[model samples]
Target: MDGQVNRVPDGGFGWVIVAAVAIINMTNQSILSVFGQLFGGELRRMNEDTFTAALITNLNSLALNFSGLFIGPAIKSFKPRNVAICGCLFVSLGLLICSMATESWHFIVGYSFFVGFGLGLISPSTFMAINSYFSSKRGRAVGVSLAGAGVGQVFMPHVVRYFLDNYDFQIAVLAMAMVSLTGIFGAMFLKPLNPPLQHNNRKHIRLLSEKDVEKCQVTPQAETVHQPSEESFSKKMLSRLVQALDLELLKDFVFWSIIVGMALVYTATINFTMIFPSFLRHSVDLNSQLVATCMSVVAFADIICRLLLPCLTDYLRIPYRVVFLLGTLGLFVARMFLAETKDLRVIIAMSVLTGMMKSATVINNNLTISSHCRSEKLAGGLGLSMMSKGLIVITVGQLLGWIRDYFDSYVICLYAQSVILFLVVIVWSPEIYYRYRRQKRTTTKSIETTIEAGVEEVAKLNA
Candidate 1:
């Protein structure tokens, strides 16, 4: 026990890591929201159709999500702080380059490709840093860190709108690039609990003493530990790369289930935000100011719910899966009502409800996924989910655009979202129920066996 390292500090420097990651997320979300709001105006400026503009935004999202695929390797090979710094630079460079763009293709290449990749690099690193520091209050830390998006959402529209109104698009973009540079400062502080291990194919199995059993469990932290290489250069490098990708996760059914379910949840919640400003303008004929106001309402509501719901869940001892399901149900109801509402007030109310559901779901998403696997598998599971979500975005992007383009109604788009959400819930709910029942039965049998074994031991001692 003398030389053993305590795994998680649970507080102290961990909260500092949380703050730094929160700032990174806040800036990233702000940039994303600004781009979403600018889609229509930029399309008009470039003389491009809505479909083309939507494709670009979807691609941007796809890049951002897909970047997670590389994060596992990046973190393994580089320090989290170094990777984060590189990510911030990529984001800043992307935005700066986009300011010089004169064509639709330029925007796609600059904003979608560069910025999205930068985001992909930063996203996992943020959560991983938080995870390194906090174990006991991880749920709370996740909620607080992600709430940065809400904070960004609350004010970023007005800031971006002011810049768009007062200056040319190029100047506005330039200002955003300048704003993004601050993220580098945040990234600088993202020190991990310890230097993560270099990637190795060998597994670590610690033989715990009976007294230490309650204090520590088997973990994949060796994924974080680095040792001197003992193999040929090419073979060692190849093994590290393979270890970083963690491709073996593809065999997991539970992992697939969580990813598919998350894809559906994302399609219903965050994806809607990317396209909602266009919906308000096209369907309801709302002015830019009003549209921004509605978006802000959603942001404000999301912040409030995110701040409160996680704490409440902890106090009430609610299961993460149950809360996540309830959140999805709320999102479905909100979307259904949103499709039918004509009044601005009703739409705004539904937006607020949507935000609350999104917040609740986001808070629990990581927990739900991690529950399905060992601690070491968490990074791989998240990467797989991100890759799956990106693929789903590519397919769904066209459908969403077609609904708006051919149908000429945002209501249809909202309806499409509600249906997708409903179907996912229907399909996944049975799995959750069956798994719950099986776990409960297994637990009961274990208890019975333990009791019988205890009785036999007592009889032997008396004899």
Candidate 2:
């Protein structure tokens, strides 16, 4: 197994874990992205307003992402595999129930609550497990893992539409439910990393070193003192709960910046998925074949970029934040161009480019979140980020639906999304500058210290 408690396994079973995560995300996240395609069918099935249809999708997104708040705690207490199995079961049940949905609340409960919660549980646990396996090739590994979802996005939409066209929404939902069950097979392959032990004195957590034993010795006296502090079971449980949720992560500036900045990118991408199809079909008066072709191009481009960009970033040794910002710029340009374009071919090209930009950001999102986080804190960090994503989707989602209802303008939506991305760049600019300054200062100080040491050595030799 090549298991090392503190260090990443880097290979061996880690690749299996990555493959497992890839499959898990393939089933879960693909559906999350393609709900835009499902929106019109859901609307007709439920006979709902635009806002209501959008809300259904938003709730699904919200639940899937909002459930991340608890996944950190759950996976910390239970094994990753165990958590994923439960998620798989929940997702299957949710989809099965959704196939029979006769009301809005049915979907809200089945798809949003159950399916979303399952997705939330699966992603963090799998990601945390995958992270324990690789360090150096982490970017490439993450890109590969998420690319499964991209691959699914490439084909699942078309498959779903085929069913919708030939049969009905119920059959499509039922078929998806069957696919959800496959995740359980993948979940079985997800192995947990070695458990961490508590340090006796300061209550620090430490995993075993290569010796397969605790490398740091602990005093009996310190252990005794720590035991007494744990006498209050209620307090200990409450503390454990809070720690599990990683509420402490909320105070971190870097974490906050990452989530907030990604939120803008997410808001735009999510809105695109929810509205773009309908916008093309009705608003632009595009034929169904052209719209479908554009979507397929976008999905395929997204898949290619998801696989390619992370490797490229690793090769170039670019910072994830820098890569993320560059993607934001690309998307902003695409969106602004979309707003100005009425030509079908230009829009199609832009859609592919938009997908490429969005996928680049999505592939980097996990790397960006985990890059600055400690191993113990990674799950909570991702959970919190997902929570933020959920909230943003909930807020912007309704506004997008309302915009469509009121204005009937996809161009306006693109413009609005573009403005938000611009704001993200504006907000992130100073932070990037500050980081540059800090790094420069650190380098200059190290050089001055080296120069001083050399001078002292010369003085001693001369004397």
Candidate 3:
């Protein structure tokens, strides 16, 4: 397996993996994007407060992301394909369980724990599979895969609404469960990369030279020297676990900053998506069909941006952090504007802008980490990022709900989301400027040193 780690096919079958991941993402994201539309109204109808609805909604997010702590190790210990398949089964079962729910706790257990954890498992495995397959065009590959979610967003709401309009709520959820089952077939296509990628100190995947390969080769005699006592075995297991989790990444300032910024941004944006439908229904007084249309408009806009923006950024050679900051800032402005407006046309325009900004941030979410971490540690970095986001969402997400209930307005929630996004911009903008200045200084110093060396070489030759 060590022999093949360096030779990424870069394309070819990698596109196949990309398509499979898109399918999985489409399935996962469609359900999440409309979770509130599906259950929030019903919960409200049952006299459950906004806080209870938010609790149930965020619980799924919490479980989905929190499980990343275990997901990293699980992917390392098992095949990505197998892990994904298991995740699909869990998601399907969870949806089925949701279909039979008679109480709020049932939704919490079924959707929050089971579906969330299942998605947690599927997400990193698919991400790792895509990363393992592509190196040079990773931006485009990730964009294409994420575009699947946009496609889902475009259609799933209407589909869900159709079932709700024609059939019962339980039937709609059951249909969703059957739809989730299709992800298993996609998971099956995630054939393990031969000589699977390994972690190293380098941030990028590079081909190992023959000399490096020789150095990596282990001698039988060296292996025999390590006799495993019970204590030694336990230590070895602990070390392996730690290695798999990539706990060392916590020490990186840039990584931690990215994690925090992305977490806050994600919490704000995702909560908005989950809550927006409810806001439209209760506050804006939009009908179900109109709300579905608005969601589809957002999805349509999202799909256009997801398909175009990443590739454009890659072509322009834009720094991922810069793009992320711009996107977050745009989201903040859009949310603020959205908060002040009740006009449907203005709201639709803001939705379009929000979707575009969302695409930018979502594309860069993992790309930022990938730029900072070693290729092998990508899974761990992503897992830890998800875990951080999960923690923040559960805490802050509930707070948003409380703000809505206390103030008796979803507009307050929108303003609160804008504030959180503003914080992300504040945190990242200065850091980006600092990095730019530092890199410029280093370039200037290197050029001056080169000029001095050239001058001395010419003087010596003339003499």
Per-residue lDDT tens digits for candidate 2, residues 79-128, read: 67888989988998998888898887887788888988888788777777
Off by over 4 Å in 2: 1-6, 33-52, 157-172, 196-241, 458-463
Error of 1 at 448 (Å): 3.8
Ranking by lDDT: 3, 2, 1
Superposed model 3: Cα runs more than 4 Å off: 1-7, 34-52, 161-171, 197-240, 278-293, 342-345, 447-463
User: Each model's TM-score, in the order given?
Assistant: 0.82, 0.84, 0.82
User: What shift in Å separates residue 241 of candidate 1 from its native position after superposition?
Assistant: 5.7
Clashes of 3: 1
Off by over 4 Å in 1: 1-6, 36-46, 161-168, 198-242, 274-293, 343-346, 450-463
Top lDDT model: 3
Query: Candidate 1 lDDT, tens digit per residue, 329-350?
Result: 8899998887777699898999
* Deviation of model 2 at 346, angstroms: 2.8
